[model samples]
Target: MKKLILTVLLSLSGVVAATAQPMCCYNPVLNCIATRTSVRQYAPTAIPDSVTTTLLQAAMCAPSAVNKQPWEFITVTNPEVRNAIKQAIPNSHAAKAPLCIVVCGDMNQALEGQARDFWVQDCSAATQNILLAAHSMGLGGVWCGVYPNTDRCEALCKVLKIPANVIPLNVVCLGYPDPNAPAPTPKDKFKPAKIHVNAW
Candidate 1:
């Protein structure tokens, strides 16, 4: 009810975990993980600050390598800024969402030498936490990669005014799922054959 109808539009448009699933049915955490899906179509209403805070708190709780939590999050709600970022990447929906959280790695805070690559894993874990947290909060989001792609990284750096020491890992596009869009079936990724007993 964004363009067609007026709902109370806040600054952080939020909600839309799963309309099909009953709220009383999930075991909170497990429900979030199991029902989570990548949402592209979103309502334009803004989310509450408290909800955003919860998402960030969950993200920061992620474990890091060598205790080096070198992740940085840039929460974007400005339409112009989001559009600018969208233009920087191919097939990016960052601009479409009501809020775009850009997760970055602070290389300066990362471990030294051979362990430098650990920042990637650390940041990735943080991203996953955000995604799950969003779902749990009844919000929909998708992870848009940025780190490994040189063009994207560089472009984002310029757009976001990121310093030389920080690297944007990915963009978490978030918003309330559009009620009108058809809900797709959630994928079942469990693979018994891939499991190995002690080692592969």
Candidate 2:
């Protein structure tokens, strides 16, 4: 009877130990953020429509300036359109991605007066959200700049037939990462010198 009681106590102790383990020991958000690296190379697999919708939902959830959400998204999956975009920006490797999302800002939707200038910032936030969401979903993505460059912007606008009021900010190239490709090393970017106590 004592041996059986000892076995029961041991089992209870094991259960207690297991239950004592912290649930937050593995933080998915932090893991996702840390593991997120710009992926220029991708596999040939296609992204599903459900995943695309989730990514767009994540992008749209970003905060805007003065509640003026002026961002728009255009998903380009067609080979012809992707080729044209590639031709427009010869330096960008995003054309090779399985899916490309064009993030845009609408001038008409911007707040009036000086606040209108904040549309770029709002759109940029949305773009970042999309990239983070893609990474969290185990997909890879890279942000290819477009808005500031007049030539590149004009070329994309012409190719995509974008409207006058809407400005393409950037293109997010997304896909499953190529397994053969080398993973980028995560760097320690924290700098104590960059921090200021009160004023510089």
Candidate 2: Cα lDDT at 74: 93
Model 2, 54-83: lDDT tens digits are 999999999999888999999988877898
The residue-level lDDT of candidate 2 at 59 comes to 92
Clash pairs, model 2 backbone: none
Task: Report the lDDT tens digits of candidate 1 across residue range 1-200.
Answer: 57544454432243443443454376776667778999988998898888999999999999999898999999999999999999987677977899999999999999999999899999999999999999887799999999799999999999999999999999999999999998756777777799999999
RMSD over all Cα atoms, model 2: 7.9
Lowest lDDT sum, 10 consecutive residues, model 1, at 8-17
- Give residue 192's lDDT in candidate 2 (0 to 100): 75
TM-score of each: 0.85, 0.84
